[model samples]
Target: MSFTQRLRRRLFPPRDAIEGYENEELVDTICRKTAAYQGQANWPLVADLTTVLDFGGGAGVHYKTARQQSPDIRWAVVETPAMVRRAMELATDRLRFFERIEEAADWLGNVDLIHSNGAIQYVPNPVRTIRSLCAVAPAKLIWHRVPISEGEGRREVQTSYLSDNGPGQAPSLAEKLVRYERTWIPEQAFIRAHEGYRMAERSPDPREHGTYQFRFVPD
Candidate 1:
Protein backbone atom coordinates (compact mmCIF):
# COMPACT_ATOMS: atom_id res chain seq x y z
CA MET A 1 0.00 0.00 0.00
CA SER A 2 1.10 3.61 -0.55
CA PHE A 3 2.29 5.79 2.31
CA THR A 4 -0.92 7.85 2.40
CA GLN A 5 -3.04 4.68 2.44
CA ARG A 6 -0.90 3.33 5.25
CA LEU A 7 -1.27 6.56 7.22
CA ARG A 8 -5.04 6.57 6.82
CA ARG A 9 -5.22 2.94 7.92
CA ARG A 10 -3.11 3.68 10.95
CA LEU A 11 -4.91 6.86 11.96
CA PHE A 12 -8.54 6.10 11.12
CA PRO A 13 -8.48 2.34 10.55
CA PRO A 14 -10.88 0.61 8.16
CA ARG A 15 -13.02 -0.92 10.89
CA ASP A 16 -13.70 2.50 12.35
CA ALA A 17 -13.90 4.36 9.06
CA ILE A 18 -15.82 1.91 6.87
CA GLU A 19 -19.30 2.60 8.18
CA GLY A 20 -19.23 6.36 7.69
CA TYR A 21 -22.92 6.74 8.42
CA GLU A 22 -22.11 6.13 12.08
CA ASN A 23 -19.96 9.22 12.25
CA GLU A 24 -21.38 11.88 14.55
CA GLU A 25 -20.41 14.68 12.19
CA LEU A 26 -22.39 13.16 9.31
CA VAL A 27 -25.40 12.84 11.62
CA ASP A 28 -25.06 16.46 12.59
CA THR A 29 -24.85 17.44 8.94
CA ILE A 30 -28.02 15.50 8.18
CA CYS A 31 -29.91 17.18 11.01
CA ARG A 32 -28.72 20.53 9.78
CA LYS A 33 -30.01 19.75 6.28
CA THR A 34 -33.35 18.82 7.79
CA ALA A 35 -33.55 22.34 9.10
CA ALA A 36 -32.54 23.77 5.72
CA TYR A 37 -34.88 21.73 3.55
CA GLN A 38 -35.90 25.05 1.92
CA GLY A 39 -39.39 23.95 0.94
CA GLN A 40 -38.21 21.21 -1.38
CA ALA A 41 -41.02 19.15 -2.80
CA ASN A 42 -41.77 16.49 -0.20
CA TRP A 43 -43.86 14.17 -2.37
CA PRO A 44 -45.74 14.75 -5.59
CA LEU A 45 -48.77 12.70 -4.48
CA VAL A 46 -49.17 14.75 -1.31
CA ALA A 47 -52.92 15.18 -1.50
CA ASP A 48 -55.03 13.23 1.00
CA LEU A 49 -51.99 11.51 2.44
CA THR A 50 -52.09 10.57 6.13
CA THR A 51 -49.25 8.17 6.92
CA VAL A 52 -45.93 7.46 5.18
CA LEU A 53 -42.89 5.24 5.55
CA ASP A 54 -39.63 6.95 4.61
CA PHE A 55 -37.15 4.21 3.86
CA GLY A 56 -33.52 5.15 4.38
CA GLY A 57 -34.56 8.61 5.51
CA GLY A 58 -31.59 9.87 7.45
CA ALA A 59 -32.60 12.34 10.17
CA GLY A 60 -36.04 12.35 8.58
CA VAL A 61 -35.18 15.36 6.42
CA HIS A 62 -38.29 14.98 4.24
CA TYR A 63 -40.54 15.53 7.23
CA LYS A 64 -39.84 19.27 7.19
CA THR A 65 -41.75 19.97 3.98
CA ALA A 66 -44.14 17.07 4.52
CA ARG A 67 -45.41 18.53 7.76
CA GLN A 68 -45.87 21.88 6.07
CA GLN A 69 -47.95 20.27 3.31
CA SER A 70 -49.89 17.92 5.57
CA PRO A 71 -49.98 19.11 9.14
CA ASP A 72 -51.26 15.83 10.54
CA ILE A 73 -49.11 13.52 8.44
CA ARG A 74 -47.70 10.61 10.40
CA TRP A 75 -44.20 9.81 9.10
CA ALA A 76 -41.87 6.97 10.04
CA VAL A 77 -38.24 6.83 9.03
CA VAL A 78 -36.35 3.56 8.61
CA GLU A 79 -32.61 3.95 8.76
CA THR A 80 -29.39 2.26 9.84
CA PRO A 81 -29.00 1.40 13.51
CA ALA A 82 -26.43 4.13 13.96
CA MET A 83 -28.64 6.72 12.24
CA VAL A 84 -31.69 5.53 14.15
CA ARG A 85 -29.87 6.06 17.44
CA ARG A 86 -28.97 9.62 16.57
CA ALA A 87 -32.22 10.38 14.71
CA MET A 88 -34.54 9.47 17.57
CA GLU A 89 -33.66 12.80 19.15
CA LEU A 90 -35.43 14.50 16.24
CA ALA A 91 -38.54 12.33 16.50
CA THR A 92 -41.92 13.66 17.53
CA ASP A 93 -45.53 12.48 17.84
CA ARG A 94 -45.97 12.61 14.08
CA LEU A 95 -42.40 11.62 13.18
CA ARG A 96 -40.48 8.57 14.36
CA PHE A 97 -37.44 6.40 13.53
CA PHE A 98 -36.85 2.69 13.16
CA GLU A 99 -34.03 0.30 12.28
CA ARG A 100 -36.25 -2.13 10.44
CA ILE A 101 -38.82 -1.71 7.67
CA GLU A 102 -41.35 -3.96 9.39
CA GLU A 103 -41.29 -1.95 12.61
CA ALA A 104 -41.82 1.30 10.75
CA ALA A 105 -44.66 -0.19 8.73
CA ASP A 106 -46.29 -1.51 11.90
CA TRP A 107 -45.87 1.84 13.62
CA LEU A 108 -47.80 3.58 10.88
CA GLY A 109 -50.46 0.78 10.84
CA ASN A 110 -51.39 1.63 7.26
CA VAL A 111 -48.71 3.30 5.24
CA ASP A 112 -50.32 5.51 2.61
CA LEU A 113 -46.99 5.89 0.81
CA ILE A 114 -43.50 4.45 0.97
CA HIS A 115 -40.79 6.79 -0.24
CA SER A 116 -37.10 5.97 -0.62
CA ASN A 117 -34.80 8.51 -2.20
CA GLY A 118 -31.18 7.69 -2.94
CA ALA A 119 -31.27 4.76 -0.55
CA ILE A 120 -32.23 1.45 -2.12
CA GLN A 121 -28.89 0.96 -3.83
CA TYR A 122 -26.96 1.00 -0.58
CA VAL A 123 -28.48 -2.18 0.80
CA PRO A 124 -26.60 -5.45 0.42
CA ASN A 125 -29.54 -7.14 -1.24
CA PRO A 126 -31.78 -4.74 -3.13
CA VAL A 127 -34.13 -7.46 -4.35
CA ARG A 128 -34.72 -8.86 -0.87
CA THR A 129 -35.17 -5.44 0.61
CA ILE A 130 -37.59 -4.53 -2.15
CA ARG A 131 -39.58 -7.69 -1.45
CA SER A 132 -39.78 -6.86 2.25
CA LEU A 133 -40.99 -3.38 1.48
CA CYS A 134 -43.57 -4.91 -0.86
CA ALA A 135 -44.82 -7.04 2.03
CA VAL A 136 -45.76 -3.81 3.79
CA ALA A 137 -48.45 -3.33 1.14
CA PRO A 138 -48.31 0.42 1.05
CA ALA A 139 -50.84 2.20 -1.13
CA LYS A 140 -48.03 3.70 -3.22
CA LEU A 141 -44.24 3.41 -3.54
CA ILE A 142 -41.73 5.93 -4.85
CA TRP A 143 -38.01 5.40 -5.38
CA HIS A 144 -35.60 8.11 -6.48
CA ARG A 145 -31.93 8.17 -7.44
CA VAL A 146 -32.06 4.48 -8.18
CA PRO A 147 -29.02 3.32 -10.17
CA ILE A 148 -30.01 1.01 -12.95
CA SER A 149 -28.00 -1.20 -15.31
CA GLU A 150 -29.03 -2.81 -18.55
CA GLY A 151 -26.61 -5.73 -18.22
CA GLU A 152 -25.39 -7.70 -15.21
CA GLY A 153 -25.58 -6.22 -11.74
CA ARG A 154 -22.44 -5.11 -9.90
CA ARG A 155 -21.23 -3.71 -6.59
CA GLU A 156 -19.21 -0.59 -6.12
CA VAL A 157 -17.77 1.48 -3.33
CA GLN A 158 -19.02 5.04 -2.89
CA THR A 159 -16.87 7.74 -1.37
CA SER A 160 -18.51 10.87 -0.05
CA TYR A 161 -17.07 13.91 1.62
CA LEU A 162 -18.92 15.61 4.48
CA SER A 163 -20.11 18.40 2.23
CA ASP A 164 -21.94 15.96 -0.04
CA ASN A 165 -24.65 15.43 2.56
CA GLY A 166 -26.53 18.71 2.49
CA PRO A 167 -29.52 20.74 1.47
CA GLY A 168 -27.76 23.94 2.50
CA GLN A 169 -24.33 25.40 2.91
CA ALA A 170 -21.91 23.09 4.72
CA PRO A 171 -19.13 23.97 7.07
CA SER A 172 -15.67 23.73 5.58
CA LEU A 173 -13.59 21.01 7.09
CA ALA A 174 -10.37 19.13 6.44
CA GLU A 175 -10.45 16.14 4.10
CA LYS A 176 -12.95 13.80 5.76
CA LEU A 177 -14.05 10.79 3.78
CA VAL A 178 -16.95 8.39 4.23
CA ARG A 179 -16.98 5.14 2.25
CA TYR A 180 -19.84 2.72 1.71
CA GLU A 181 -20.90 -0.04 -0.66
CA ARG A 182 -23.69 0.21 -3.22
CA THR A 183 -25.14 -1.99 -5.94
CA TRP A 184 -26.28 -1.29 -9.49
CA ILE A 185 -29.00 -3.74 -10.36
CA PRO A 186 -30.46 -4.57 -13.74
CA GLU A 187 -33.50 -2.45 -14.49
CA GLN A 188 -35.79 -5.33 -15.33
CA ALA A 189 -34.85 -7.18 -12.17
CA PHE A 190 -35.54 -4.08 -10.16
CA ILE A 191 -39.02 -3.73 -11.65
CA ARG A 192 -39.84 -7.41 -11.14
CA ALA A 193 -38.95 -7.19 -7.47
CA HIS A 194 -41.97 -5.04 -6.80
CA GLU A 195 -44.24 -8.06 -6.77
CA GLY A 196 -47.65 -6.50 -6.14
CA TYR A 197 -47.03 -3.05 -7.54
CA ARG A 198 -47.23 -1.80 -11.10
CA MET A 199 -45.02 0.93 -12.43
CA ALA A 200 -47.11 4.09 -12.55
CA GLU A 201 -44.40 6.50 -13.56
CA ARG A 202 -40.80 6.40 -14.72
CA SER A 203 -38.56 9.41 -15.12
CA PRO A 204 -34.84 9.94 -15.46
CA ASP A 205 -33.12 11.75 -12.61
CA PRO A 206 -31.28 14.54 -14.36
CA ARG A 207 -29.07 15.25 -11.42
CA GLU A 208 -27.39 11.82 -11.29
CA HIS A 209 -26.41 9.86 -14.36
CA GLY A 210 -27.86 6.32 -14.74
CA THR A 211 -30.28 7.03 -11.91
CA TYR A 212 -34.06 7.12 -12.31
CA GLN A 213 -37.25 7.74 -10.38
CA PHE A 214 -39.97 5.15 -10.30
CA ARG A 215 -43.47 5.39 -8.89
CA PHE A 216 -45.59 2.33 -8.29
CA VAL A 217 -49.14 1.67 -7.16
CA PRO A 218 -51.37 -1.35 -6.64
CA ASP A 219 -50.99 -3.75 -9.59
Candidate 2:
Protein backbone atom coordinates (compact mmCIF):
# COMPACT_ATOMS: atom_id res chain seq x y z
CA MET A 1 0.00 0.00 0.00
CA SER A 2 1.09 3.62 -0.48
CA PHE A 3 2.25 5.62 2.52
CA THR A 4 -1.00 7.59 2.51
CA GLN A 5 -3.07 4.45 2.54
CA ARG A 6 -1.05 3.03 5.38
CA LEU A 7 -1.23 6.22 7.38
CA ARG A 8 -4.95 6.70 6.82
CA ARG A 9 -5.59 3.11 7.76
CA ARG A 10 -3.60 3.56 10.91
CA LEU A 11 -4.76 7.05 11.75
CA PHE A 12 -8.36 7.19 10.57
CA PRO A 13 -9.72 3.69 10.60
CA PRO A 14 -13.30 4.69 9.86
CA ARG A 15 -12.61 7.28 7.15
CA ASP A 16 -12.81 5.58 3.79
CA ALA A 17 -11.45 8.15 1.34
CA ILE A 18 -8.99 11.02 1.19
CA GLU A 19 -11.87 13.42 0.71
CA GLY A 20 -13.23 12.42 4.12
CA TYR A 21 -9.84 13.14 5.62
CA GLU A 22 -9.75 16.55 3.88
CA ASN A 23 -13.06 17.49 5.52
CA GLU A 24 -11.59 16.73 8.92
CA GLU A 25 -8.52 18.75 8.04
CA LEU A 26 -10.49 21.88 7.23
CA VAL A 27 -13.01 21.59 10.07
CA ASP A 28 -11.29 24.21 12.23
CA THR A 29 -11.16 26.73 9.37
CA ILE A 30 -14.81 26.17 8.59
CA CYS A 31 -15.80 26.65 12.21
CA ARG A 32 -13.69 29.72 12.96
CA LYS A 33 -14.32 31.52 9.65
CA THR A 34 -17.99 30.68 9.81
CA ALA A 35 -18.24 32.16 13.28
CA ALA A 36 -16.37 35.31 12.24
CA TYR A 37 -18.66 35.93 9.29
CA GLN A 38 -21.86 35.02 11.12
CA GLY A 39 -21.66 38.10 13.33
CA GLN A 40 -20.30 40.47 10.68
CA ALA A 41 -22.45 42.72 8.54
CA ASN A 42 -20.43 42.43 5.33
CA TRP A 43 -18.33 40.05 3.29
CA PRO A 44 -17.19 36.48 3.85
CA LEU A 45 -20.90 35.98 4.38
CA VAL A 46 -24.24 37.67 4.55
CA ALA A 47 -27.21 36.33 6.47
CA ASP A 48 -29.26 36.87 3.35
CA LEU A 49 -28.12 36.46 -0.26
CA THR A 50 -24.34 35.95 -0.34
CA THR A 51 -21.64 35.07 -2.85
CA VAL A 52 -18.04 34.08 -2.06
CA LEU A 53 -14.97 33.55 -4.20
CA ASP A 54 -12.37 31.37 -2.51
CA PHE A 55 -9.15 31.81 -4.44
CA GLY A 56 -6.76 28.85 -4.56
CA GLY A 57 -9.41 26.90 -2.70
CA GLY A 58 -8.29 23.25 -2.78
CA ALA A 59 -10.89 20.54 -3.01
CA GLY A 60 -13.16 23.07 -1.23
CA VAL A 61 -13.76 20.88 1.79
CA HIS A 62 -13.85 24.02 3.94
CA TYR A 63 -16.95 25.13 2.08
CA LYS A 64 -18.69 21.81 2.58
CA THR A 65 -19.70 22.47 6.19
CA ALA A 66 -20.04 26.18 5.46
CA ARG A 67 -22.67 25.35 2.85
CA GLN A 68 -24.79 23.77 5.56
CA GLN A 69 -24.44 26.80 7.79
CA SER A 70 -25.33 29.32 5.08
CA PRO A 71 -27.58 27.70 2.56
CA ASP A 72 -28.43 31.07 1.07
CA ILE A 73 -24.83 31.68 0.01
CA ARG A 74 -23.28 31.07 -3.39
CA TRP A 75 -19.65 29.87 -3.24
CA ALA A 76 -17.06 29.43 -5.96
CA VAL A 77 -13.59 28.05 -5.33
CA VAL A 78 -10.92 28.80 -7.96
CA GLU A 79 -8.13 26.25 -8.04
CA THR A 80 -5.90 24.26 -10.38
CA PRO A 81 -7.52 22.26 -13.11
CA ALA A 82 -7.05 18.95 -11.28
CA MET A 83 -8.39 20.28 -8.02
CA VAL A 84 -11.15 22.06 -9.90
CA ARG A 85 -12.10 18.80 -11.57
CA ARG A 86 -12.51 17.02 -8.27
CA ALA A 87 -14.21 19.90 -6.51
CA MET A 88 -16.48 20.37 -9.51
CA GLU A 89 -17.67 16.80 -9.21
CA LEU A 90 -18.91 17.63 -5.72
CA ALA A 91 -20.57 20.88 -6.81
CA THR A 92 -24.14 21.61 -5.80
CA ASP A 93 -26.59 24.44 -6.34
CA ARG A 94 -24.97 26.55 -3.66
CA LEU A 95 -21.35 25.54 -4.22
CA ARG A 96 -19.16 25.39 -7.33
CA PHE A 97 -15.50 25.40 -8.33
CA PHE A 98 -13.60 27.22 -11.07
CA GLU A 99 -10.12 27.01 -12.61
CA ARG A 100 -9.60 30.73 -12.86
CA ILE A 101 -10.49 33.69 -10.64
CA GLU A 102 -11.38 35.76 -13.71
CA GLU A 103 -14.39 33.55 -14.35
CA ALA A 104 -16.22 35.53 -11.65
CA ALA A 105 -15.54 38.91 -13.26
CA ASP A 106 -19.26 39.33 -13.75
CA TRP A 107 -19.55 39.52 -9.96
CA LEU A 108 -17.61 42.78 -9.88
CA GLY A 109 -18.69 45.13 -7.09
CA ASN A 110 -21.30 42.66 -5.89
CA VAL A 111 -19.53 39.46 -4.95
CA ASP A 112 -20.11 40.16 -1.25
CA LEU A 113 -17.11 38.09 -0.06
CA ILE A 114 -13.66 37.06 -1.24
CA HIS A 115 -11.43 34.78 0.80
CA SER A 116 -7.88 33.51 0.36
CA ASN A 117 -6.66 31.35 3.18
CA GLY A 118 -3.07 30.12 2.97
CA ALA A 119 -3.18 31.03 -0.71
CA ILE A 120 -1.37 34.28 -1.50
CA GLN A 121 2.03 32.90 -0.62
CA TYR A 122 1.71 30.32 -3.33
CA VAL A 123 0.60 32.78 -5.98
CA PRO A 124 3.24 33.62 -8.58
CA ASN A 125 2.83 37.33 -8.05
CA PRO A 126 0.71 38.12 -5.01
CA VAL A 127 0.45 41.79 -5.95
CA ARG A 128 -1.02 40.92 -9.32
CA THR A 129 -3.23 38.34 -7.66
CA ILE A 130 -4.62 40.81 -5.15
CA ARG A 131 -5.13 43.36 -7.89
CA SER A 132 -7.34 40.92 -9.70
CA LEU A 133 -9.21 40.22 -6.50
CA CYS A 134 -9.64 43.92 -5.82
CA ALA A 135 -11.05 44.36 -9.29
CA VAL A 136 -13.85 42.00 -8.34
CA ALA A 137 -14.56 44.59 -5.64
CA PRO A 138 -16.17 42.42 -3.05
CA ALA A 139 -17.44 44.13 0.07
CA LYS A 140 -15.00 42.27 2.29
CA LEU A 141 -11.81 40.25 1.91
CA ILE A 142 -10.49 37.56 4.22
CA TRP A 143 -6.71 37.22 3.98
CA HIS A 144 -5.61 34.50 6.33
CA ARG A 145 -2.69 32.20 7.04
CA VAL A 146 -0.20 34.25 5.04
CA PRO A 147 3.48 33.86 5.99
CA ILE A 148 5.34 37.13 5.97
CA SER A 149 8.87 38.29 6.54
CA GLU A 150 9.37 40.93 9.21
CA GLY A 151 11.93 43.16 7.53
CA GLU A 152 10.78 44.08 4.04
CA GLY A 153 8.35 43.24 1.30
CA ARG A 154 9.91 40.97 -1.30
CA ARG A 155 8.87 38.04 -3.41
CA GLU A 156 10.49 34.65 -2.91
CA VAL A 157 10.63 31.43 -4.87
CA GLN A 158 11.54 28.53 -2.63
CA THR A 159 11.44 24.79 -3.14
CA SER A 160 9.75 22.69 -0.50
CA TYR A 161 7.37 19.79 -0.08
CA LEU A 162 3.96 21.24 0.66
CA SER A 163 0.92 19.57 2.12
CA ASP A 164 -2.72 20.21 1.26
CA ASN A 165 -4.01 20.76 4.77
CA GLY A 166 -2.42 20.79 8.18
CA PRO A 167 0.08 18.07 8.80
CA GLY A 168 -1.87 14.88 9.42
CA GLN A 169 -0.81 11.84 11.48
CA ALA A 170 2.50 11.43 9.65
CA PRO A 171 3.56 14.66 7.95
CA SER A 172 5.71 12.81 5.49
CA LEU A 173 2.70 11.08 4.05
CA ALA A 174 1.40 14.26 2.43
CA GLU A 175 4.62 15.86 1.29
CA LYS A 176 4.48 16.68 -2.41
CA LEU A 177 7.48 16.81 -4.73
CA VAL A 178 9.79 19.78 -4.37
CA ARG A 179 7.97 22.87 -5.59
CA TYR A 180 8.75 26.55 -5.86
CA GLU A 181 6.42 29.17 -4.35
CA ARG A 182 6.39 32.95 -4.19
CA THR A 183 5.56 34.81 -0.97
CA TRP A 184 5.53 38.39 0.16
CA ILE A 185 5.10 40.30 3.41
CA PRO A 186 2.63 42.48 1.49
CA GLU A 187 3.18 46.18 0.99
CA GLN A 188 0.48 48.61 2.07
CA ALA A 189 0.49 50.54 -1.19
CA PHE A 190 -1.54 47.97 -3.09
CA ILE A 191 -4.51 48.10 -0.78
CA ARG A 192 -4.15 51.85 -0.58
CA ALA A 193 -4.52 52.21 -4.31
CA HIS A 194 -7.56 49.97 -4.46
CA GLU A 195 -9.67 53.06 -3.51
CA GLY A 196 -12.86 51.49 -2.18
CA TYR A 197 -11.36 49.42 0.62
CA ARG A 198 -9.50 50.01 3.84
CA MET A 199 -7.53 47.65 5.99
CA ALA A 200 -9.85 47.37 8.96
CA GLU A 201 -8.14 44.67 11.02
CA ARG A 202 -4.87 42.81 11.40
CA SER A 203 -4.08 39.88 13.64
CA PRO A 204 -1.41 37.24 13.99
CA ASP A 205 -2.59 33.84 13.01
CA PRO A 206 -3.04 31.70 16.11
CA ARG A 207 -0.80 29.16 14.45
CA GLU A 208 3.03 29.20 14.44
CA HIS A 209 3.53 30.02 10.77
CA GLY A 210 4.37 33.69 11.60
CA THR A 211 1.55 34.70 9.31
CA TYR A 212 -0.88 37.59 9.66
CA GLN A 213 -4.51 37.86 8.69
CA PHE A 214 -5.83 41.09 7.24
CA ARG A 215 -9.42 42.12 6.69
CA PHE A 216 -10.29 44.71 4.09
CA VAL A 217 -13.62 46.49 4.09
CA PRO A 218 -15.34 49.27 2.20
CA ASP A 219 -13.92 52.66 3.04
Q: What's the TM-score of each model vs. the native?
A: 0.86, 0.67
How much does candidate 2 score in TM-score?
0.67
User: lDDT of each structure?
Assistant: 0.84, 0.61
- After superposing candidate 1, which stretches have Cα over 4 Å from the reference? 1-19, 35-38, 41-44
- Write the residue-wise lDDT of candidate 2 on 116-211 in tens digits: 887777765777778778878788888888776655677655543223342223232333323344566545644554557898888888864678
- Winning candidate number (lDDT): 1
* Model 1 Cα lDDT, one tens digit per residue, 174-206: 446678888998999999999989999999998
